[model samples]
Target chain A: MKKIQILGTGCPKCRKLTELAEKAADELGIAYELIKVTELDEIMRFGVMMTPGLAVDGEVKAAGRIPDVEEIKKMIA
Target chain B: MAECCGGGNRLVYACSGGADVGEIADRVARKLVKTGFARPSCLAGVGGHVPGFVASATGDVVNIVIDGCSVACALKTLEQVGADMTHFVLTDMGLKKGRTPVEDAVIDRIAETIRIKSSGRVEESPASTHDGCACGGC
Candidate 1:
């Protein structure tokens, strides 16, 4: 199963990104697990200097902002 | 993040920063809950090291992390707690980080993304019980 993680605090953009991710995954018909990372210490461990990041299979792909759906599909695909 | 069952009860957390993208993420999360896509979870609880919150986050449901920028503060939080997440970033969506104008079209696009993602999952049942934590005060 593919693991999808959304990293951020409980903010607006973070939540929006979460929704987009779900859509992309469903559209692709891939089974994925989604997790939210909201702690400061935990967030820092990923070496992310910003809020709202993206991690796939334990790897940080995007950080500091929300990505487009097409880009998200590419990341998950 | 609180874990329930299926995407209906899936937890969503955002960076909630003071920037434009942050606001967008926050708004999107609210819209997702209103539209019955996923249940809004507490990001602070996970950040504050609340045991119950952490325990709830561990399970079979989807946990979403949304961030406004590349700092990925929210993503790091979950990682620190040893929890996995399906992450998204606004900057990656072609939205510039930092101060920017919030547009309705942008918000609509974000909402559409969420709807598309949750299309095949269990639709949030109308009879589904609401814990009333959408405000994250729990």
Candidate 2:
């Protein structure tokens, strides 16, 4: 199963990003496990200073802003 | 030490998080740039690994990270990318992260601390040799 991680520091944008990611995943039938990376140390390991970031299988695909459902679907797809 | 600090290859980054101390950190960085203590630089670039920002941060210039609190956002951003840098945290400077006030006096003090820390370490320009090469290393 593919791993989808939302890297953030619990900021508002981070929360919104999570919702978007979950919505996208649900619609795509990706059969993926979604994890939210929240700790400062763990977030730092992803090297994202921005509030919200998206990672697929440990690879960062988008950061700093919320990508739309279609864009996120493409990223996870 | 020079009375006025200026004209160096220095890059500065500030966490600028939403907390009160984050405001202080951001202001201090801007003050350093306004006073010519260092060139204002971006944290996101280093975090994003943008080639230009990465190259600039790791170049021969001195790099400094000013973070709001122990969260060390600015410091970690540079450190994660392997960019050698010096850092200061507002909390370490005696300001509480959430309770600190973002005042002119506080900003000035932080900038001054940076100046004091930098005076002894500013790199001297390489001397030009008889062959007209200015490299510090022969």
Candidate 3:
């Protein structure tokens, strides 16, 4: 199962990223675990400074900006 | 160090290029560290996506980025890791990139400029983003 981690402090962008990431995963038909990391400390542990970061498994694929659903599908797939 | 004394960590990263201004930027960052204005951190680590290094740059800490020229490699690297930073460019301070002399006096002047600006509100770099790069022939 892919572990999809969203790192953010619960801003609008963060929510948008989460929604997009979920849509991408569903479209890809992949089994995944969605984790919301809202704490600053935990978000930093993922090596992400910008909010609304997306990580696949344990590797960070994107930070500081939200990638579109197609882009996110590529990240998890 | 007054700004960072009672606050979180202040990490300094310099562009240390192969030019004269690069040397000045490096020396200024070292001076900042020596004078306790900030702690020296690794730009290479952040570029390589090292988790610990990236984490250190986040949160309540202050990431001070000094670039030698308009290339802004140091600033770009930290930005990839989502670091919020105050940036400076030596060339923007009237120092020519290749023509400038790498003197302690010059380094001190630039360092003082950084110290003064950093002590108060953060100054964003004029060319802060990848879009600012004109290497695409645009």
Candidate 4:
């Protein structure tokens, strides 16, 4: 199972990123655990200075803006 | 003795979103500059992580961030770039998010709020010596 984490303080864009990430994961039919890292300290541990960061299996795949679903699917894959 | 933002100690960022409040934030920011209340700031530059903008936001000067409503786009962008800024939300100033008409009175009121932080010249102190002219250039 892949662990997908979205890092942010749950801002509007962060919530949007989570929604997109879930859509991508469900379509792939991949057994994945989705997590939202909202705590500032925890988010910083990933070395992501920007909110709306996407991480897969402990590795940061994207940061800052909301990536499109196609790009997110690729990241999860 | 290098100058940042044209040597101005006050910087203001407006929420340039696509809503009534957003437009109010933007107009208020421009009006502030026009009246010498603050220097202009780029919300996009801060959000995009531009080094120059980031430096100013986190610099010694005070950065005033204005948002149209509770969405707080300008404030968040500044936070992302590690900019410790003073913030003002228009809706909090009695302007309803969708109903407030954008006008000079509204813009001036918002600008006055930010201007208060720097000095007491809410409407600019009258000339020390009034020039006796009808042009009102005193």
- Candidate 3 local lDDT, residue B18: 95
What does fnat come to for each candidate?
0.00, 0.00, 0.08, 0.00
User: Per-residue lDDT of B1-138 in model 2, one digit per residue for the tens?
Assistant: 111112455667999999999988889988887775666568987788864456456555567789999999888889887888888988998998778778998899989998778654555431111211111111
Model 4: chain B TM-score vs. truth?
0.78
TM-score of decoy 4: 0.52
Per-prediction TM-score, chain B alone: 0.77, 0.83, 0.81, 0.78
Per-residue lDDT of model 1, residues B62-82, tens digit only: 567788889988898888777
lDDT string for model 4 (A1-77, tens) is 99999876655667788999999999999999999877656765665534457889987776545788998999999
Question: For residue B70, what is the lDDT in candidate 3?
Answer: 97
Candidate 3 residue lDDT tens string, A33-63: 9997776667666656444567888777776
Query: Which regions of candidate 2 are displaced past 4 Å?
Result: A1-77, B1-6, B124-138
Ten consecutive residues with minimal summed lDDT in candidate 3 chain B? B129-138
Error of 4 at A56 (Å): 34
Local accuracy of candidate 4 as per-residue lDDT tens digits, B1-138: 111011234667898778899999999888876775565557886687654456446644467788999989898888886767788888888989879888988888778876776454223432111111100011
Score every model by TM-score. 0.53, 0.55, 0.55, 0.52
Clashing pairs in model 3, backbone N/Cα/C closer than 3 A: none
- Winner by DockQ: 3
Clashing pairs in 2: none
